[model samples]
Target chain A: MALARWPYDDLFRLFSGQAGPAPRETAGVFPPVNLYDDGSVFLVRTEIPGMDKTSIEVTTAGDQLTIRGERVVAPAEPGASYHRRECDGGQFRRTVTLPQPVDAEAIEATYKNGVLEVRLPRVPERKPRKIAVA
Target chain B: MGTQVQKTEAGTQNPEIQVREKQAVTREPGTWEGPYFEPRVDIYETADALTLMAEVPGAEAEDLQTDLKDNLLTVSAKVARVDPRWKPLYEEYSVGHYLRQFRLGEQIDQAKISANLKDGVLTLTLPKAAAAKPRRIKVTGG
Candidate 1:
């Protein structure tokens, strides 16, 4: 799938100032996603492990697809202290602009084993007609 | 740590292994220097072993490597590159190598380490050493 660089990435970085050889990828985002286009449809797969199915929401509007979800952080066991807290749980929103015009009604989405996959079929190209001799 | 002297028929030899222990994971913000993304991990401690679950999306099972040496454990995995035919349009997640490490305690049995990858999640089980397990002794009335 054709993915334009998230325009706000640089702006967010400006304030985050987490600059270095490494970028803070998950400082705010919850689920990481992979998007691709194969000349027919744009496919998106996101990793949302241990998330309830009902919390996820997928929507499309004005050539843009938005995925919003919330991941609840599980309560710690009694008398337990965390040694490491790398994973994060909270509400996350990701909106991607479509590379080409697509049939909005033909979109298909599925979630399995904590991975969410969405397929957006491109609208068919119109054939050019030959002009009659004048 | 200095090596212990072992007496043997064929002269004295120092077979004692020298092990360096790193401190346990602490909540020291900004301790991670350099430029590298930290993969998310979940640690579960049980009576038998400590289970570690790391999220390494887009990584293949064969491409992951778990190494342990001198009480320092490292987990690294190579994330497969995207298809060259499709150009990046809008990207929120940067695809690159996944690297994370931990310093295991002496209570762990390094010999029985096990790892498995499924649905982009890597699960590692570090069994506890026999001496680390809790034991109950019977007491008789004196």
Candidate 2:
């Protein structure tokens, strides 16, 4: 039997023989994300728990934004025994291609309560042109 | 109505039917804590293979124990909540015992069962016995 791994197949069928959503491939590290549009900007919220701010790195280029972070498993609590562990740790990366062009210079990111929110502002020049008809 | 709670010649009650009864009664205890605290689950089932999802959150590996006695499959786990110096603002979630019981029916291939957990999700795959699985006969060609 074959085992699933990172950078997995795009069109793989699960045990139910049902195909999952199309594979979203962009060169980078990041888990599933939600992007919201607020008319003039885009807000991307990513769930990254148990990670400190120092371990995260963010950047925006053209219409593409990438967020990279790592969560190191702290030294086992003193006198702690292994039972069951269920949290996802280690390094994570995500690259998102926005639907509309964004102003790379004014992009902003904020982290709170283990969630990373990235905001991409729209360009002043492309801010809905208005003119009088001759 | 389809539940097999009726008496049979074997004298003892069918465990699978009892488990279904218990599942229907409890529904989801401590469910009023809102929708965010959802415990991940995995289910494996078949026509005869009784399905069960083991929820053992906050329980260490060693504390969890699963045993089948007289057709009753009992799953028990314990979770201890330690409150440090920091006080909780609005704590609705509670940490306590995580236990569930099921009466398993025959035709369960318990020996070939598999369990694994990833990202807080626990999955158990229980394959059915040879006689329980749906099989098709091969036709011979001339």
Candidate 3:
């Protein structure tokens, strides 16, 4: 629950026995995310299927990275009855605090097959460096 | 196979089995009783088929499996762990197999089922059987 306010924080909470709210909220948000650090890059991935790429918005401010999007629920057919409904369909906003300073100009995000991956390259000064000794 | 179908049919009618059937549909960590984590899933029905979408990042197409036995459909995948070389400073997300099973009703045509994976989401299409689909009958002499 340390990063509870963030989007991918629930994923971290899972390991500590902290639970997220029960599913089945009528106005629930969609798309769960995964955040990670790989030496020189920070990776943020979100699951959002059937969404138009144009609708998603990614923005960075100071040390926070925000992902906002809308999941449009398919309209119900005239006589269709749901046997199971688990997908959340609506607008959602999730922001995570970056662990380290990132190169704003070097960040790149790519969306493919329902998964959006945002790569944030670490700033030169923040990256690990090897020192030479005499 | 016949007995399995009978069990499936019986399971649908029996309230107890229905409860257990849905009981296995737990997502994430807290609610489930076992160590195995259930994949995030979304099941939707169209006019001809039911589309099941699951979020399983890190899983490649080759690592996924979709099995149909009796009236149960099981989707499972093996997600490889991150590179051991890199030490995790802030850790989250589990690395293991993603699993989930659903009891398919008589409406589904098991023979025509298909699946495909893109990025990380797995999509399965279960086409409805002819008898299960809505039909409009017309009187020839009317």
lDDT of each: 0.64, 0.49, 0.63
As for candidate 1, its interface RMSD to one decimal place is: 13.1
Q: Report the C-alpha lDDT of model 1 over B1-142, residue by residue, as the tens digit.
A: 9898733235323221111121222333322332234567887666677778776656678878888887788887766555676533334456555677788764889889999876566788888899886678899999
Assess every candidate by TM-score. Answer: 0.62, 0.41, 0.61
**After aligning candidate 2 to the native by TM-score, how far in Å is the CA of B123 from where it should be?**
24
- Which lDDT value does model 1 have at A34? 57
lDDT of 3 by residue, B37-90 (tens): 467677777779888877665677887888888879888876655565443333
Runs off by more than 4 Å, candidate 2: A1-30, A125-134, B1-34, B37-142
- Tens digits of per-residue lDDT, candidate 2, A1-134, equal 01112232321342235545324332323344555555667676654544577778987777777777666544333443333343334555556666668888888887653456677886756466689899
- Sort by TM-score, top down from the best: 1, 3, 2
User: Per-prediction DockQ scores?
Assistant: 0.08, 0.02, 0.12
Better candidate by TM-score, 1 or 3 = 1
Model 3: CAPRI class = incorrect
Per-residue lDDT value at B107 in model 3: 76
Best by DockQ: 3
Give the fraction of true interface contacts kept by model 2.
Answer: 0.00
